[model samples]
Target chain A: MEMEKLYRMHSDRVYSYIYLLVRHRECAEDLTQETFYKAYKGLEAFNKQASTATWLLKIARNVTYDYFRRKRVIKFFSFDKGHDLETNALSPESRYEQKEQLARMFATLSKLKKDYQEVLLLRKIQECSIQETAFILGWTEAKVKMKMTRALEALKKEFHKEGGHPNGTIKRI
Target chain B: MEPSKEFDELFEEMKEVERSEEAKRNTWLALKGRIATKRKRNIFPAFISLAIVAIATFLIITYSIPSETEQSAESLSNEEIIRAVLEREYNGPDKEHLRLMNDWMKFQSERNAKNQEEYDELLESKEYKDFMNYYQTTFGEYFTENMLTKAISTVMVFKYHYYLEDTDIEMHLENVEIKQEKDHPNIYRPIIEVSLTNSQGQKIFHTLREEFIFSKSEPGKIGSYNVAKGGGSIEFREKIENFNSYVGGNEDVRTPSFRKTISFDTLCFNGKIFENENTQKNIHGCTSDRKKINSILKIFDHLPIKEATEQESRKRAEALPQMDNYQIYLTNEVDKGTTFYTITLYEDGVLMFAPGLDLGILGDITTAPHAVIYEKVKLMLDEFSDN
Candidate 1:
């Protein structure tokens, strides 16, 4: 496929997926840089497991997951910057309902463990197939299916406990 | 069926909201910019690495050429000569030279009681000539000038042997009369004052009138030396060309033989030189003043022609650790309180880390050490490696 045509076609979808993972515009922008950087570097690795969009989304998913994994590793070791101040989030009404939902999704998702949150986001919201999700997360297909079910159930429980904000309503769609 | 169609409408609306051209361009542009930046970043480091290689090569070439050319003319200081002599004895080809020196010291001591004829015989020995020749040739010209000077000085010493007791041994300058004693013709007595202090700053002991004996004879010109108890005896007779002039009657000189050894009971007591409150305050003040001096000197060291920027100052300040062996901690902003400076000796690596101190004086915050900031990034990398 022509690189420019592929970029034109998939860039919006890629950005949408990334926006959900990192809510802030600046962070989302940075992640998009990392995602494309990864994509360009590993362009030859794209074997036909799914569509090119799915392949790019998978790359974005893994990149985003790796970012969180790095962050968690740092936090776990007490090597991170101190959580000295509360973080700020975007307004719910500024973007469209889906984008807003994605932003809201990130705020809550940031609270969950890296593994559980990654599986849930890729399988549920991005609507990636079980095999694709498994491949992207480097998990077995069966494990992806099992974890996706468990993660959704866990998310439901968490959303209900938090009184059903965007994350709770995300499931109703 | 109609309600299902309405639900499809909601999904279409969701897709519409999710898919935006602006978001796509923003993300693509962001990625494109980063790729450009990554490429740009490599250029500077590549250029810098080449520059460093060129500079390092130049320095090594310059350092090697001069040292090899002037190997003979290189002059060693007294300290260097002492270290070389000590090292030679440590790794001597044969222990014969060592035995000869020890024998000479003993024979010269014993000759003091004998007649001139016996003393003269001792001085003209082949072993003495061999020892002198070996020291002069092995050490080259550097060692001869310094060693000869040191050997001919008058030495005054007070023996405490008592580590726990700090003694005050005073040698009155007025009482320091240099007089040739009638009994010992070659020796003259000069009184000198000495003081000793214990760890607790207590004067544990006191003394006076310690005598230092020195020979007045010209060392290189001395044809022979006579050692005798009664009426003196000539131990050796050798016509040497010239003698070292460190004996007496010349310019003011502090002979190392008039050495003072301050014995300390413990390691804590050994640092008594700096442990004094006055000394502590003096060092603290001196370090701050030196920082300013270094700041001004660094401007010349780095720029040579231009003034320093904040970043330049920061880099220069960081490099100061190499100049002075002290570790500087940028405890606060450069504009704030004095940064603490300490010297740390790491035994494992045999490394010395000295960071310069910044007291925030001179109203120039630009002079703050950059090591404090640069170390943060290193600490982060170390933490990453640990995981």
Candidate 2:
């Protein structure tokens, strides 16, 4: 019940973060299960300085990378280079169906340096605080802020480059 | 031209990207199996604790503390059933935490000279650190220090209590409406209404309908699993609506292409239309202001993006009935004199309704918080006011 209670409190956010990283539903769920199992095994190490959400996310991040390591898709330079990074089915344009501009923004986003995408997802999409984002990325807050500015600038340029038009929609057959 | 404003709206809109219930349930069901083994291993410690309690009770008391499972769960009455459900959520370990939080909240919120002095002394006392340690594990979600000091209005307090105890400042369950689906005989539907008086002396209400499926053989149980759905339901249903689909071989898939534009000549916003003075365009407006019309139409270009299902649309309408409706009409071909697209804006929240790419898309609507589209239209109108 204790571990189950913890899962009920924080699994969705953890799963969401992992899904975006892994790009496969089943893979993400497996990673989420692994992260919780790790947390259960490593409960003594939790020093109470961080929120349970924060601690769980740190574990989830590690579990996802460990999975990538096992798969031998070791992407060092482009941290955003996860499975399906280039897939048309999972493009930002298709992911955001409500707003074409948002779809455009994400499309532009995917084109930037992959590190930029990594920072932006944490800062922008996840809505993590700078301190939390820094902790998860194992970078300083100053670096996170600096990277965010550069990423937004690059995104603006990429967005305007395409005239932000020709919005891609998947017509099924 | 305001990229900043555009980005702000898009970022805010990003929050509306929904997660489906299927995902949440599937992940939990799959993970529970692995956890069950760990739970079984934990029983040994409890066995040892029970032995220790037996030895201590002979020295300390005349009788042993009674076993908890004195009665079977099978024969629980309706009152007992509801109690079982609530008891599951507000477990024994959390009751003291809940009570202490409420007391701390009262001290923080309704603080007078007398109460403040007592609390300040308590803060100085050694128990404060022990108290903080006690609550750290219980309130893993909220910032305890922040709750006690800053953040006016006790919103976090209210939210914390609401999630844990089905309570706000003071929550009262008004009623429960029970019904059985005629088509699905074994399924039970309970519509529960709860009202709470917030710290601001205002009433806030929440009503949730949770389905409990009963197997005929099991008289007391409601399905294999149940979760009271009050705390964690997302606004955007993550179920992607079918816009375009066909078949390939024996398998099924879709090739999605993003569309940037849709066509309409006549724009009717909130029952006001401007007629194109030339009349050749067959467009009508409030004052024939094409600039305002263009700006207004620009916002809806790719809009009504995600389609809401009939069930989800109906659920939202019932849940948020306070929203005022404002409908807009767009004519595809004025010569045909038919309304091709329709947008009905609910004032509290924005729900854009439109014709589905000239397809048979009935519920072509997507919701955004705070009537963003309505505000955008108003802003465009103000920009072109002189014209």
Candidate 1 Cα errors over 4 Å, as ranges: A69-113, A165-173, B1-23, B30-387
Quality class of the docking in candidate 2, CAPRI style:
incorrect
lDDT of 1 by residue, B1-387 (tens): 332132232223223224345766666766655543542322111212233334434544454344453432235433333233323322212344445555655555556423334434654554434443333344324322322222211100011111111222211111122334689653433222122222333211111221223223422221211222321111100000011121112222121110122211111000011234344211111222334333322221211011234564554445433332222232333333443332221111111222334321111221112222222322322332312
Model 1, position B50: C-alpha lDDT score: 31
Tens-digit lDDT string for candidate 2 (B1-59): 44333355555544443345786666666666554444332311121223333333342
Which lDDT tens digits does candidate 1 get at residues A1-173? 53345667776667657765554455555676677777765654567777787788877877776877877731111111321111134344433444434343434445556676777656555667888787777789989877766665665455445443442134432
TM-score of model number 2: 0.34
lDDT of 2 by residue, A1-173 (tens): 25667888888888877776666667778888888888876664577766788788889988988998899773322223333222244546555443445556556666778677777777776788888888888889999988888877777677668566322332222
Q: What DockQ do the predictions score, one after another?
A: 0.10, 0.08
True contacts kept of 1: 0.22
